[model samples]
Target: MPTGLVALLDDVAAIAKVAAASLDDIGVAAARAGTKSAGVVIDDAAVTPQYVTGFHPSRELPMIWKIAKGSFKNKLIFLLPAAVLLGQFAPFLIPIILILGGLFLCYEAAEKVLEWLHVDETTKHDEPAIVEGHGREEEMVSGAIRTDLILSAEIMAIALSEITDEVWWQQGIILAVIGIVITVGVYGAVALIVKMDDVGLHLATENEGVVAAFGRGLVAFMPKLLTTLSIVGTLAMAWVGGGLLVHNIAAVGWHGPEHLIEIISHPLLGLFPESAEMTVGGIAFALLSGILGVLVGAGIAPLVHRFFPHGAEANE
Candidate 1:
Protein backbone atom coordinates (compact mmCIF):
# COMPACT_ATOMS: atom_id res chain seq x y z
CA MET A 1 0.00 0.00 0.00
CA PRO A 2 2.83 2.43 0.83
CA THR A 3 4.50 1.69 -2.52
CA GLY A 4 1.23 2.25 -4.34
CA LEU A 5 0.79 5.57 -2.53
CA VAL A 6 4.29 6.67 -3.57
CA ALA A 7 3.54 5.76 -7.20
CA LEU A 8 0.35 7.75 -7.05
CA LEU A 9 2.25 10.76 -5.68
CA ASP A 10 4.81 10.43 -8.44
CA ASP A 11 2.09 10.38 -11.11
CA VAL A 12 0.41 13.41 -9.57
CA ALA A 13 3.69 15.31 -9.58
CA ALA A 14 4.25 14.55 -13.25
CA ILE A 15 0.76 15.73 -14.15
CA ALA A 16 1.23 18.91 -12.16
CA LYS A 17 4.50 19.62 -13.97
CA VAL A 18 2.84 19.20 -17.33
CA ALA A 19 -0.01 21.47 -16.42
CA ALA A 20 2.38 24.13 -15.18
CA ALA A 21 4.41 23.98 -18.38
CA SER A 22 1.28 24.27 -20.47
CA LEU A 23 0.19 27.36 -18.53
CA ASP A 24 3.59 28.97 -18.96
CA ASP A 25 3.44 28.31 -22.67
CA ILE A 26 0.02 29.84 -22.82
CA GLY A 27 1.23 32.96 -21.01
CA VAL A 28 4.12 33.49 -23.41
CA ALA A 29 1.94 32.97 -26.45
CA ALA A 30 -0.75 35.22 -25.06
CA ALA A 31 1.74 38.05 -24.56
CA ARG A 32 3.18 37.73 -28.06
CA ALA A 33 -0.25 37.37 -29.67
CA GLY A 34 -1.67 40.23 -27.60
CA THR A 35 1.12 42.50 -28.77
CA LYS A 36 0.40 41.72 -32.42
CA SER A 37 -3.26 42.66 -31.98
CA ALA A 38 -2.64 45.71 -29.79
CA GLY A 39 -3.95 48.12 -32.40
CA VAL A 40 -7.34 46.43 -32.60
CA VAL A 41 -7.35 46.29 -28.83
CA ILE A 42 -7.03 50.07 -28.70
CA ASP A 43 -9.72 50.48 -31.27
CA ASP A 44 -11.92 48.11 -29.28
CA ALA A 45 -11.31 50.09 -26.14
CA ALA A 46 -11.96 53.35 -27.95
CA VAL A 47 -15.14 52.39 -29.81
CA THR A 48 -16.96 50.60 -26.97
CA PRO A 49 -17.93 53.73 -25.10
CA GLN A 50 -19.73 55.13 -28.09
CA TYR A 51 -22.18 52.27 -27.63
CA VAL A 52 -22.82 53.26 -24.04
CA THR A 53 -23.27 56.93 -24.78
CA GLY A 54 -26.69 58.42 -23.92
CA PHE A 55 -27.57 55.47 -21.66
CA HIS A 56 -28.87 56.04 -18.17
CA PRO A 57 -26.09 56.20 -15.62
CA SER A 58 -27.40 53.07 -13.94
CA ARG A 59 -27.58 51.12 -17.18
CA GLU A 60 -24.01 51.75 -18.32
CA LEU A 61 -22.37 49.07 -16.19
CA PRO A 62 -25.05 46.54 -17.00
CA MET A 63 -24.75 47.20 -20.72
CA ILE A 64 -21.00 46.77 -20.60
CA TRP A 65 -21.47 43.52 -18.64
CA LYS A 66 -23.76 42.15 -21.31
CA ILE A 67 -21.31 43.03 -24.05
CA ALA A 68 -18.41 41.51 -22.16
CA LYS A 69 -20.29 38.22 -21.79
CA GLY A 70 -21.01 38.14 -25.52
CA SER A 71 -17.39 38.88 -26.20
CA PHE A 72 -16.43 35.75 -24.24
CA LYS A 73 -18.83 33.70 -26.35
CA ASN A 74 -17.24 35.14 -29.47
CA LYS A 75 -13.83 33.93 -28.34
CA LEU A 76 -14.66 30.56 -26.83
CA ILE A 77 -17.37 29.20 -29.10
CA PHE A 78 -16.76 30.84 -32.48
CA LEU A 79 -13.30 32.35 -32.93
CA LEU A 80 -11.44 29.59 -31.12
CA PRO A 81 -12.82 26.73 -33.22
CA ALA A 82 -12.55 28.71 -36.46
CA ALA A 83 -8.92 29.52 -35.70
CA VAL A 84 -8.13 25.90 -34.95
CA LEU A 85 -9.64 24.74 -38.22
CA LEU A 86 -7.87 27.44 -40.21
CA GLY A 87 -4.58 26.52 -38.64
CA GLN A 88 -5.07 22.81 -39.27
CA PHE A 89 -6.32 22.98 -42.84
CA ALA A 90 -5.97 26.22 -44.79
CA PRO A 91 -3.04 27.98 -43.10
CA PHE A 92 -2.47 30.13 -46.18
CA LEU A 93 -5.98 31.54 -46.01
CA ILE A 94 -5.31 33.06 -42.57
CA PRO A 95 -3.19 35.86 -43.94
CA ILE A 96 -5.73 36.68 -46.63
CA ILE A 97 -8.51 36.93 -44.08
CA LEU A 98 -6.31 38.95 -41.75
CA ILE A 99 -5.56 41.35 -44.56
CA LEU A 100 -9.25 41.79 -45.19
CA GLY A 101 -9.79 42.44 -41.49
CA GLY A 102 -7.00 44.99 -41.59
CA LEU A 103 -8.62 46.68 -44.56
CA PHE A 104 -11.86 46.93 -42.60
CA LEU A 105 -9.93 48.57 -39.78
CA CYS A 106 -8.40 51.01 -42.23
CA TYR A 107 -11.83 51.88 -43.59
CA GLU A 108 -13.16 52.55 -40.11
CA ALA A 109 -10.17 54.78 -39.37
CA ALA A 110 -10.63 56.72 -42.59
CA GLU A 111 -14.31 57.18 -41.91
CA LYS A 112 -13.43 58.64 -38.52
CA VAL A 113 -10.91 60.98 -40.15
CA LEU A 114 -13.48 62.12 -42.70
CA GLU A 115 -15.90 62.81 -39.93
CA TRP A 116 -13.23 64.68 -38.01
CA LEU A 117 -12.55 66.88 -41.02
CA HIS A 118 -16.29 67.59 -41.24
CA VAL A 119 -16.32 66.18 -44.77
CA ASP A 120 -19.23 63.85 -44.04
CA GLU A 121 -20.29 64.31 -40.45
CA THR A 122 -23.84 63.45 -41.41
CA THR A 123 -22.71 60.00 -42.47
CA LYS A 124 -21.60 59.26 -38.96
CA HIS A 125 -24.33 57.73 -36.84
CA ASP A 126 -25.81 60.13 -34.36
CA GLU A 127 -26.69 58.68 -31.00
CA PRO A 128 -30.16 57.16 -31.14
CA ALA A 129 -32.83 58.47 -28.80
CA ILE A 130 -31.70 58.04 -25.20
CA VAL A 131 -35.21 57.34 -24.04
CA GLU A 132 -35.71 53.80 -22.77
CA GLY A 133 -38.17 51.43 -24.42
CA HIS A 134 -39.97 48.59 -22.72
CA GLY A 135 -36.92 46.42 -23.27
CA ARG A 136 -34.40 48.91 -24.66
CA GLU A 137 -31.59 47.70 -22.44
CA GLU A 138 -31.72 44.24 -23.99
CA GLU A 139 -31.72 45.69 -27.49
CA MET A 140 -28.73 47.92 -26.77
CA VAL A 141 -26.84 45.07 -25.14
CA SER A 142 -27.55 42.79 -28.09
CA GLY A 143 -26.34 45.40 -30.55
CA ALA A 144 -23.15 46.03 -28.61
CA ILE A 145 -22.49 42.27 -28.42
CA ARG A 146 -22.82 41.90 -32.18
CA THR A 147 -20.36 44.75 -32.68
CA ASP A 148 -17.93 43.13 -30.25
CA LEU A 149 -18.15 39.90 -32.24
CA ILE A 150 -16.80 41.61 -35.36
CA LEU A 151 -13.98 43.33 -33.51
CA SER A 152 -13.25 40.19 -31.51
CA ALA A 153 -13.05 38.23 -34.75
CA GLU A 154 -10.34 40.57 -35.93
CA ILE A 155 -8.49 40.32 -32.64
CA MET A 156 -8.62 36.54 -32.55
CA ALA A 157 -7.51 36.16 -36.13
CA ILE A 158 -4.59 38.49 -35.63
CA ALA A 159 -3.58 36.68 -32.47
CA LEU A 160 -3.95 33.21 -33.99
CA SER A 161 -1.77 34.12 -36.94
CA GLU A 162 0.99 35.26 -34.60
CA ILE A 163 1.41 31.92 -32.82
CA THR A 164 4.70 30.63 -34.21
CA ASP A 165 4.66 26.88 -33.54
CA GLU A 166 2.36 25.27 -31.07
CA VAL A 167 -0.23 22.52 -30.75
CA TRP A 168 -3.86 23.29 -31.61
CA TRP A 169 -4.93 23.16 -27.97
CA GLN A 170 -2.09 25.45 -26.98
CA GLN A 171 -3.06 27.96 -29.61
CA GLY A 172 -6.66 27.78 -28.51
CA ILE A 173 -5.79 28.42 -24.88
CA ILE A 174 -3.58 31.35 -25.78
CA LEU A 175 -6.26 32.82 -27.98
CA ALA A 176 -8.83 32.29 -25.25
CA VAL A 177 -6.65 33.99 -22.65
CA ILE A 178 -6.11 36.92 -24.98
CA GLY A 179 -9.82 37.24 -25.63
CA ILE A 180 -10.72 37.29 -21.95
CA VAL A 181 -7.88 39.59 -20.92
CA ILE A 182 -8.52 42.10 -23.68
CA THR A 183 -12.30 42.04 -23.28
CA VAL A 184 -12.06 42.49 -19.55
CA GLY A 185 -9.40 45.16 -19.85
CA VAL A 186 -11.27 47.08 -22.52
CA TYR A 187 -14.78 46.89 -21.04
CA GLY A 188 -13.43 47.40 -17.55
CA ALA A 189 -11.80 50.55 -18.80
CA VAL A 190 -15.02 51.48 -20.55
CA ALA A 191 -16.96 51.10 -17.34
CA LEU A 192 -14.58 53.41 -15.54
CA ILE A 193 -14.57 55.88 -18.41
CA VAL A 194 -18.33 56.08 -18.91
CA LYS A 195 -18.90 56.46 -15.19
CA MET A 196 -16.34 59.16 -14.46
CA ASP A 197 -18.99 61.83 -14.59
CA ASP A 198 -21.25 59.90 -12.30
CA VAL A 199 -18.40 59.24 -9.93
CA GLY A 200 -17.45 62.90 -10.06
CA LEU A 201 -20.98 64.01 -9.50
CA HIS A 202 -21.22 61.82 -6.43
CA LEU A 203 -17.86 62.92 -5.13
CA ALA A 204 -18.57 66.57 -5.74
CA THR A 205 -22.01 66.44 -4.18
CA GLU A 206 -20.90 64.33 -1.21
CA ASN A 207 -17.47 65.60 -0.32
CA GLU A 208 -17.02 69.18 0.86
CA GLY A 209 -13.32 70.01 0.55
CA VAL A 210 -10.43 69.70 -1.91
CA VAL A 211 -11.99 66.35 -2.74
CA ALA A 212 -14.95 68.17 -4.22
CA ALA A 213 -12.65 70.29 -6.35
CA PHE A 214 -10.85 67.19 -7.62
CA GLY A 215 -14.16 65.58 -8.47
CA ARG A 216 -15.06 68.56 -10.59
CA GLY A 217 -11.71 68.27 -12.36
CA LEU A 218 -12.35 64.59 -12.99
CA VAL A 219 -15.67 65.41 -14.57
CA ALA A 220 -14.02 67.96 -16.85
CA PHE A 221 -11.10 65.75 -17.90
CA MET A 222 -13.22 62.72 -18.85
CA PRO A 223 -14.70 64.25 -21.99
CA LYS A 224 -11.36 65.45 -23.30
CA LEU A 225 -9.81 62.04 -22.64
CA LEU A 226 -12.65 60.28 -24.44
CA THR A 227 -12.22 62.51 -27.49
CA THR A 228 -8.46 62.03 -27.54
CA LEU A 229 -8.81 58.26 -27.22
CA SER A 230 -11.25 58.18 -30.12
CA ILE A 231 -8.95 60.24 -32.34
CA VAL A 232 -5.85 58.25 -31.42
CA GLY A 233 -7.73 55.01 -31.94
CA THR A 234 -8.60 56.13 -35.48
CA LEU A 235 -5.03 56.87 -36.42
CA ALA A 236 -3.72 53.67 -34.87
CA MET A 237 -6.27 51.66 -36.82
CA ALA A 238 -5.19 53.32 -40.07
CA TRP A 239 -1.50 52.83 -39.42
CA VAL A 240 -1.82 49.21 -38.32
CA GLY A 241 -4.21 48.34 -41.12
CA GLY A 242 -1.97 49.97 -43.69
CA GLY A 243 1.07 48.12 -42.38
CA LEU A 244 -0.82 44.81 -42.53
CA LEU A 245 -2.03 45.50 -46.07
CA VAL A 246 1.44 46.32 -47.30
CA HIS A 247 2.96 43.21 -45.75
CA ASN A 248 0.14 40.88 -46.85
CA ILE A 249 0.37 42.17 -50.41
CA ALA A 250 4.08 41.47 -50.36
CA ALA A 251 3.44 38.11 -48.77
CA VAL A 252 1.18 37.09 -51.66
CA GLY A 253 3.11 38.29 -54.74
CA TRP A 254 2.72 41.93 -55.62
CA HIS A 255 4.93 44.43 -53.81
CA GLY A 256 4.17 47.15 -56.26
CA PRO A 257 2.38 49.49 -53.84
CA GLU A 258 4.96 49.06 -51.10
CA HIS A 259 7.90 49.45 -53.48
CA LEU A 260 6.40 52.51 -55.09
CA ILE A 261 5.81 54.12 -51.69
CA GLU A 262 9.39 53.38 -50.65
CA ILE A 263 10.62 54.99 -53.83
CA ILE A 264 8.51 58.09 -53.20
CA SER A 265 9.85 58.60 -49.66
CA HIS A 266 13.43 57.58 -50.54
CA PRO A 267 14.32 61.23 -51.17
CA LEU A 268 13.00 62.83 -47.92
CA LEU A 269 15.05 60.54 -45.71
CA GLY A 270 17.29 62.91 -43.72
CA LEU A 271 19.95 65.61 -43.98
CA PHE A 272 22.72 63.26 -42.79
CA PRO A 273 23.51 61.02 -45.73
CA GLU A 274 25.20 58.51 -43.40
CA SER A 275 22.27 57.99 -40.97
CA ALA A 276 19.82 58.17 -43.87
CA GLU A 277 21.05 54.81 -45.11
CA MET A 278 19.88 53.11 -41.87
CA THR A 279 16.77 54.76 -40.36
CA VAL A 280 15.40 56.23 -43.55
CA GLY A 281 13.98 52.88 -44.63
CA GLY A 282 11.86 52.48 -41.51
CA ILE A 283 10.60 56.07 -41.32
CA ALA A 284 9.86 56.11 -45.00
CA PHE A 285 8.02 52.81 -44.83
CA ALA A 286 5.79 53.99 -41.96
CA LEU A 287 4.89 57.26 -43.67
CA LEU A 288 4.08 55.63 -46.98
CA SER A 289 2.03 52.91 -45.30
CA GLY A 290 -0.02 55.48 -43.35
CA ILE A 291 -0.74 57.52 -46.48
CA LEU A 292 -1.74 54.41 -48.38
CA GLY A 293 -3.92 53.26 -45.51
CA VAL A 294 -5.88 56.49 -45.52
CA LEU A 295 -6.37 56.30 -49.29
CA VAL A 296 -7.42 52.64 -49.21
CA GLY A 297 -9.76 53.30 -46.31
CA ALA A 298 -11.40 56.22 -48.08
CA GLY A 299 -11.86 54.17 -51.23
CA ILE A 300 -13.56 51.34 -49.35
CA ALA A 301 -16.04 53.55 -47.46
CA PRO A 302 -18.15 54.44 -50.51
CA LEU A 303 -18.36 50.83 -51.53
CA VAL A 304 -19.48 49.93 -48.03
CA HIS A 305 -22.08 52.71 -48.07
CA ARG A 306 -23.34 51.62 -51.47
CA PHE A 307 -23.82 48.14 -50.08
CA PHE A 308 -25.24 49.17 -46.73
CA PRO A 309 -26.94 52.54 -46.96
CA HIS A 310 -28.23 52.80 -43.43
CA GLY A 311 -25.10 51.86 -41.53
CA ALA A 312 -26.79 52.05 -38.13
CA GLU A 313 -29.81 50.07 -39.19
CA ALA A 314 -27.73 47.47 -41.05
CA ASN A 315 -25.54 47.00 -38.03
CA GLU A 316 -28.61 46.62 -35.83
Candidate 2:
Protein backbone atom coordinates (compact mmCIF):
# COMPACT_ATOMS: atom_id res chain seq x y z
CA MET A 1 0.00 0.00 0.00
CA PRO A 2 2.85 2.41 0.83
CA THR A 3 4.54 1.64 -2.51
CA GLY A 4 1.26 2.23 -4.30
CA LEU A 5 0.83 5.53 -2.50
CA VAL A 6 4.35 6.53 -3.42
CA ALA A 7 3.62 5.67 -7.07
CA LEU A 8 0.47 7.75 -6.88
CA LEU A 9 2.43 10.69 -5.50
CA ASP A 10 4.97 10.29 -8.27
CA ASP A 11 2.19 10.39 -10.82
CA VAL A 12 0.77 13.52 -9.25
CA ALA A 13 4.16 15.17 -9.29
CA ALA A 14 4.62 14.32 -12.95
CA ILE A 15 1.24 15.71 -13.79
CA ALA A 16 2.01 18.86 -11.82
CA LYS A 17 5.26 19.33 -13.66
CA VAL A 18 3.55 18.83 -16.99
CA ALA A 19 0.91 21.35 -16.07
CA ALA A 20 3.57 23.86 -15.05
CA ALA A 21 5.43 23.30 -18.29
CA SER A 22 2.25 23.82 -20.26
CA LEU A 23 1.68 27.06 -18.42
CA ASP A 24 5.18 28.15 -19.30
CA ASP A 25 4.59 27.24 -22.93
CA ILE A 26 1.42 29.25 -22.93
CA GLY A 27 3.26 32.25 -21.51
CA VAL A 28 5.97 31.99 -24.13
CA ALA A 29 3.43 31.60 -26.90
CA ALA A 30 1.40 34.52 -25.60
CA ALA A 31 4.43 36.79 -25.54
CA ARG A 32 5.51 35.70 -28.99
CA ALA A 33 2.04 36.26 -30.34
CA GLY A 34 1.86 39.71 -28.79
CA THR A 35 5.22 40.59 -30.31
CA LYS A 36 4.05 39.38 -33.70
CA SER A 37 1.05 41.70 -33.49
CA ALA A 38 3.32 44.71 -32.83
CA GLY A 39 2.22 46.78 -35.78
CA VAL A 40 -1.48 46.53 -34.98
CA VAL A 41 -0.65 46.97 -31.31
CA ILE A 42 1.24 50.18 -32.00
CA ASP A 43 -1.59 51.42 -34.20
CA ASP A 44 -4.10 50.58 -31.49
CA ALA A 45 -2.11 52.53 -28.92
CA ALA A 46 -1.63 55.48 -31.26
CA VAL A 47 -5.24 55.75 -32.34
CA THR A 48 -6.82 55.49 -28.89
CA PRO A 49 -5.69 58.84 -27.43
CA GLN A 50 -7.72 60.72 -29.99
CA TYR A 51 -11.01 59.66 -28.41
CA VAL A 52 -10.08 61.42 -25.17
CA THR A 53 -9.32 64.74 -26.85
CA GLY A 54 -12.39 66.73 -25.88
CA PHE A 55 -13.01 65.08 -22.55
CA HIS A 56 -12.29 66.66 -19.17
CA PRO A 57 -9.08 65.49 -17.53
CA SER A 58 -10.94 63.49 -14.90
CA ARG A 59 -12.82 61.54 -17.57
CA GLU A 60 -9.79 60.37 -19.51
CA LEU A 61 -8.68 57.43 -17.38
CA PRO A 62 -12.23 56.21 -16.83
CA MET A 63 -12.95 56.33 -20.55
CA ILE A 64 -9.71 54.56 -21.29
CA TRP A 65 -10.50 51.89 -18.73
CA LYS A 66 -13.91 51.36 -20.30
CA ILE A 67 -12.37 51.04 -23.74
CA ALA A 68 -9.75 48.66 -22.39
CA LYS A 69 -12.48 46.49 -20.94
CA GLY A 70 -14.27 46.55 -24.26
CA SER A 71 -11.06 45.64 -26.03
CA PHE A 72 -10.61 42.70 -23.69
CA LYS A 73 -14.19 41.60 -24.35
CA ASN A 74 -13.59 42.01 -28.06
CA LYS A 75 -10.58 39.72 -27.99
CA LEU A 76 -11.38 37.19 -25.30
CA ILE A 77 -15.17 36.95 -25.67
CA PHE A 78 -15.80 37.56 -29.36
CA LEU A 79 -12.72 37.22 -31.51
CA LEU A 80 -11.04 34.42 -29.60
CA PRO A 81 -13.94 31.97 -29.84
CA ALA A 82 -14.69 32.94 -33.40
CA ALA A 83 -11.05 32.55 -34.32
CA VAL A 84 -10.82 29.13 -32.69
CA LEU A 85 -13.98 27.98 -34.41
CA LEU A 86 -12.74 29.30 -37.72
CA GLY A 87 -9.37 27.70 -37.24
CA GLN A 88 -10.96 24.43 -36.45
CA PHE A 89 -13.66 24.32 -39.08
CA ALA A 90 -12.93 26.95 -41.68
CA PRO A 91 -9.24 27.59 -41.68
CA PHE A 92 -9.42 28.47 -45.36
CA LEU A 93 -11.52 31.53 -44.60
CA ILE A 94 -8.87 33.22 -42.43
CA PRO A 95 -7.00 34.93 -45.23
CA ILE A 96 -10.14 36.19 -46.92
CA ILE A 97 -11.52 37.61 -43.72
CA LEU A 98 -8.18 39.19 -42.88
CA ILE A 99 -7.97 40.71 -46.34
CA LEU A 100 -11.45 42.18 -45.94
CA GLY A 101 -10.46 43.61 -42.57
CA GLY A 102 -7.34 45.06 -44.12
CA LEU A 103 -9.39 46.73 -46.82
CA PHE A 104 -11.64 48.26 -44.18
CA LEU A 105 -8.60 49.70 -42.41
CA CYS A 106 -7.39 51.08 -45.70
CA TYR A 107 -10.78 52.61 -46.38
CA GLU A 108 -10.86 54.28 -42.98
CA ALA A 109 -7.40 55.74 -43.44
CA ALA A 110 -8.28 56.93 -46.95
CA GLU A 111 -11.47 58.62 -45.80
CA LYS A 112 -9.55 60.54 -43.19
CA VAL A 113 -7.03 61.64 -45.80
CA LEU A 114 -9.72 62.78 -48.18
CA GLU A 115 -11.43 64.70 -45.43
CA TRP A 116 -8.14 66.32 -44.50
CA LEU A 117 -7.54 67.24 -48.14
CA HIS A 118 -11.05 68.74 -48.49
CA VAL A 119 -11.70 66.47 -51.44
CA ASP A 120 -14.45 64.45 -49.76
CA GLU A 121 -17.93 65.68 -50.67
CA THR A 122 -19.68 64.09 -47.72
CA THR A 123 -21.44 66.54 -45.41
CA LYS A 124 -22.11 66.23 -41.71
CA HIS A 125 -25.04 67.56 -39.71
CA ASP A 126 -24.68 68.27 -36.02
CA GLU A 127 -26.61 66.13 -33.58
CA PRO A 128 -30.03 67.41 -32.54
CA ALA A 129 -29.43 67.99 -28.83
CA ILE A 130 -25.94 67.70 -27.53
CA VAL A 131 -25.43 64.97 -25.02
CA GLU A 132 -23.97 66.05 -21.68
CA GLY A 133 -21.75 64.52 -19.04
CA HIS A 134 -22.51 60.80 -18.68
CA GLY A 135 -24.27 60.56 -22.04
CA ARG A 136 -21.41 62.21 -23.85
CA GLU A 137 -18.98 59.97 -22.02
CA GLU A 138 -21.02 56.95 -23.05
CA GLU A 139 -20.93 58.01 -26.69
CA MET A 140 -17.19 58.48 -26.64
CA VAL A 141 -16.68 55.16 -24.88
CA SER A 142 -18.93 53.40 -27.37
CA GLY A 143 -17.20 54.94 -30.36
CA ALA A 144 -13.80 54.07 -28.97
CA ILE A 145 -14.91 50.51 -28.29
CA ARG A 146 -16.33 50.19 -31.78
CA THR A 147 -13.00 51.22 -33.24
CA ASP A 148 -11.18 49.01 -30.77
CA LEU A 149 -13.29 46.05 -31.85
CA ILE A 150 -11.78 46.25 -35.32
CA LEU A 151 -8.27 46.79 -34.09
CA SER A 152 -8.62 44.03 -31.53
CA ALA A 153 -9.96 41.68 -34.12
CA GLU A 154 -6.99 42.40 -36.31
CA ILE A 155 -4.61 42.02 -33.40
CA MET A 156 -6.16 38.71 -32.37
CA ALA A 157 -6.07 37.47 -35.93
CA ILE A 158 -2.47 38.45 -36.33
CA ALA A 159 -1.67 36.68 -33.08
CA LEU A 160 -3.66 33.66 -34.16
CA SER A 161 -1.76 33.38 -37.41
CA GLU A 162 1.54 33.33 -35.55
CA ILE A 163 0.54 30.25 -33.63
CA THR A 164 1.32 26.91 -35.26
CA ASP A 165 0.38 23.29 -34.55
CA GLU A 166 -0.92 23.89 -31.06
CA VAL A 167 -4.00 22.10 -29.75
CA TRP A 168 -7.14 24.25 -29.67
CA TRP A 169 -7.12 24.66 -25.89
CA GLN A 170 -3.48 25.69 -25.90
CA GLN A 171 -4.16 28.19 -28.61
CA GLY A 172 -7.10 29.55 -26.64
CA ILE A 173 -5.06 29.92 -23.46
CA ILE A 174 -2.24 31.62 -25.32
CA LEU A 175 -4.68 33.95 -26.97
CA ALA A 176 -6.29 34.82 -23.64
CA VAL A 177 -2.93 35.67 -22.17
CA ILE A 178 -2.02 37.75 -25.18
CA GLY A 179 -5.38 39.54 -25.16
CA ILE A 180 -5.11 40.51 -21.50
CA VAL A 181 -1.49 41.58 -21.75
CA ILE A 182 -1.97 43.67 -24.89
CA THR A 183 -5.17 45.32 -23.63
CA VAL A 184 -3.45 46.33 -20.44
CA GLY A 185 -0.30 47.47 -22.19
CA VAL A 186 -1.97 49.50 -24.93
CA TYR A 187 -4.54 51.22 -22.73
CA GLY A 188 -2.07 51.72 -19.93
CA ALA A 189 0.25 53.52 -22.31
CA VAL A 190 -2.65 55.55 -23.66
CA ALA A 191 -3.72 56.52 -20.17
CA LEU A 192 -0.19 57.71 -19.54
CA ILE A 193 -0.09 59.66 -22.83
CA VAL A 194 -3.43 61.43 -22.38
CA LYS A 195 -2.53 62.45 -18.85
CA MET A 196 1.02 63.53 -19.70
CA ASP A 197 0.21 67.20 -19.90
CA ASP A 198 -1.63 66.98 -16.62
CA VAL A 199 1.40 65.36 -15.11
CA GLY A 200 3.58 68.03 -16.62
CA LEU A 201 1.31 70.77 -15.29
CA HIS A 202 1.38 69.27 -11.83
CA LEU A 203 5.12 68.97 -11.90
CA ALA A 204 5.56 72.42 -13.34
CA THR A 205 3.43 73.99 -10.63
CA GLU A 206 4.46 71.92 -7.64
CA ASN A 207 8.07 71.10 -8.37
CA GLU A 208 11.32 73.01 -8.81
CA GLY A 209 14.71 72.68 -10.59
CA VAL A 210 15.09 71.04 -14.01
CA VAL A 211 11.98 68.98 -13.32
CA ALA A 212 9.88 72.12 -13.88
CA ALA A 213 11.60 72.84 -17.14
CA PHE A 214 11.07 69.28 -18.23
CA GLY A 215 7.45 69.56 -17.18
CA ARG A 216 7.08 72.79 -19.18
CA GLY A 217 8.71 71.08 -22.13
CA LEU A 218 6.24 68.22 -21.90
CA VAL A 219 3.38 70.71 -21.84
CA ALA A 220 4.74 72.45 -24.89
CA PHE A 221 5.32 69.18 -26.73
CA MET A 222 1.91 67.55 -26.11
CA PRO A 223 -0.10 69.19 -28.87
CA LYS A 224 2.55 68.35 -31.42
CA LEU A 225 2.77 64.89 -29.95
CA LEU A 226 -0.95 64.39 -30.38
CA THR A 227 -0.76 65.62 -33.94
CA THR A 228 2.17 63.34 -34.64
CA LEU A 229 0.34 60.40 -33.10
CA SER A 230 -2.66 61.08 -35.34
CA ILE A 231 -0.52 61.12 -38.44
CA VAL A 232 1.38 58.01 -37.29
CA GLY A 233 -1.86 56.22 -36.54
CA THR A 234 -3.21 56.87 -40.02
CA LEU A 235 0.03 55.79 -41.65
CA ALA A 236 0.24 52.70 -39.46
CA MET A 237 -3.27 51.69 -40.52
CA ALA A 238 -2.34 51.96 -44.17
CA TRP A 239 0.99 50.17 -43.73
CA VAL A 240 -0.50 47.30 -41.78
CA GLY A 241 -3.47 47.01 -44.13
CA GLY A 242 -1.25 46.97 -47.18
CA GLY A 243 1.10 44.45 -45.61
CA LEU A 244 -1.75 42.10 -44.76
CA LEU A 245 -3.16 42.24 -48.28
CA VAL A 246 0.19 41.79 -49.92
CA HIS A 247 1.30 38.91 -47.72
CA ASN A 248 -2.05 37.14 -47.90
CA ILE A 249 -2.15 37.46 -51.65
CA ALA A 250 1.25 35.85 -51.77
CA ALA A 251 0.07 33.14 -49.42
CA VAL A 252 -2.75 32.26 -51.77
CA GLY A 253 -0.75 32.47 -55.01
CA TRP A 254 -0.07 35.91 -56.48
CA HIS A 255 3.30 37.41 -55.59
CA GLY A 256 3.23 40.56 -57.64
CA PRO A 257 3.24 42.99 -54.77
CA GLU A 258 5.73 40.95 -52.81
CA HIS A 259 8.03 40.75 -55.79
CA LEU A 260 7.58 44.43 -56.48
CA ILE A 261 8.48 45.35 -52.91
CA GLU A 262 11.56 43.17 -53.05
CA ILE A 263 12.56 44.65 -56.37
CA ILE A 264 12.06 48.17 -55.08
CA SER A 265 13.96 47.30 -51.93
CA HIS A 266 16.87 45.78 -53.79
CA PRO A 267 18.44 49.08 -54.79
CA LEU A 268 18.66 50.13 -51.13
CA LEU A 269 20.76 47.05 -50.43
CA GLY A 270 23.61 48.49 -52.51
CA LEU A 271 23.20 52.05 -51.23
CA PHE A 272 23.69 51.02 -47.61
CA PRO A 273 26.65 49.08 -46.21
CA GLU A 274 26.22 45.33 -45.79
CA SER A 275 25.13 45.57 -42.14
CA ALA A 276 22.32 48.04 -42.82
CA GLU A 277 21.13 46.47 -46.06
CA MET A 278 18.36 44.49 -44.42
CA THR A 279 17.22 47.52 -42.47
CA VAL A 280 17.21 49.69 -45.56
CA GLY A 281 15.45 47.02 -47.55
CA GLY A 282 12.79 46.64 -44.89
CA ILE A 283 12.23 50.40 -44.75
CA ALA A 284 12.00 50.57 -48.52
CA PHE A 285 9.55 47.69 -48.57
CA ALA A 286 7.43 49.26 -45.84
CA LEU A 287 7.35 52.59 -47.61
CA LEU A 288 6.26 50.92 -50.84
CA SER A 289 3.66 48.88 -48.99
CA GLY A 290 2.32 51.97 -47.22
CA ILE A 291 2.02 53.79 -50.54
CA LEU A 292 0.21 50.82 -52.00
CA GLY A 293 -2.11 50.76 -49.04
CA VAL A 294 -2.85 54.45 -49.48
CA LEU A 295 -3.58 54.05 -53.18
CA VAL A 296 -5.81 51.03 -52.62
CA GLY A 297 -7.63 52.79 -49.81
CA ALA A 298 -8.08 55.95 -51.85
CA GLY A 299 -9.44 53.96 -54.75
CA ILE A 300 -11.98 52.15 -52.62
CA ALA A 301 -13.11 55.16 -50.59
CA PRO A 302 -15.20 56.57 -53.42
CA LEU A 303 -16.93 53.26 -53.94
CA VAL A 304 -17.68 52.92 -50.22
CA HIS A 305 -19.00 56.49 -50.06
CA ARG A 306 -21.18 55.88 -53.10
CA PHE A 307 -22.69 52.69 -51.72
CA PHE A 308 -22.90 53.77 -48.10
CA PRO A 309 -24.06 57.27 -48.79
CA HIS A 310 -25.70 57.92 -45.44
CA GLY A 311 -22.74 58.40 -43.13
CA ALA A 312 -19.97 58.86 -45.65
CA GLU A 313 -18.71 62.07 -44.15
CA ALA A 314 -18.77 60.75 -40.61
CA ASN A 315 -15.50 61.44 -38.75
CA GLU A 316 -13.87 58.21 -37.85
Clashing pairs in 1: none
List, residue by residue over 1-316, the lDDT tens digit for candidate 2. 9999999999999999999999988888888878767767777888788677777788889889899989988988999999888777877777777788778777776766776788864633343343348988888889889888888888888778777467799888888888898899899999989999999999899999999999999999998987777678788877888888888888778999899888877876887799987788778877887888888999998887788865454345
Q: How far out, in Å, is residue 61 in model 1? A: 0.7
The positional error of residue 51 in candidate 2, measured at the CA in angstroms, is 2.0
Q: Local error of candidate 2 at 44, Å? A: 1.8
TM-score of each: 0.87, 0.85
- lDDT of each candidate versus the true structure: 0.82, 0.82
Question: Model 2 clash pairs?
Answer: none
On the 0 to 100 scale, the lDDT of residue 89 in model 1 is 80
Error of 2 at 57 (Å): 1.8
RMSD of each: 3.3, 3.4
lDDT of 2 at 122: 64
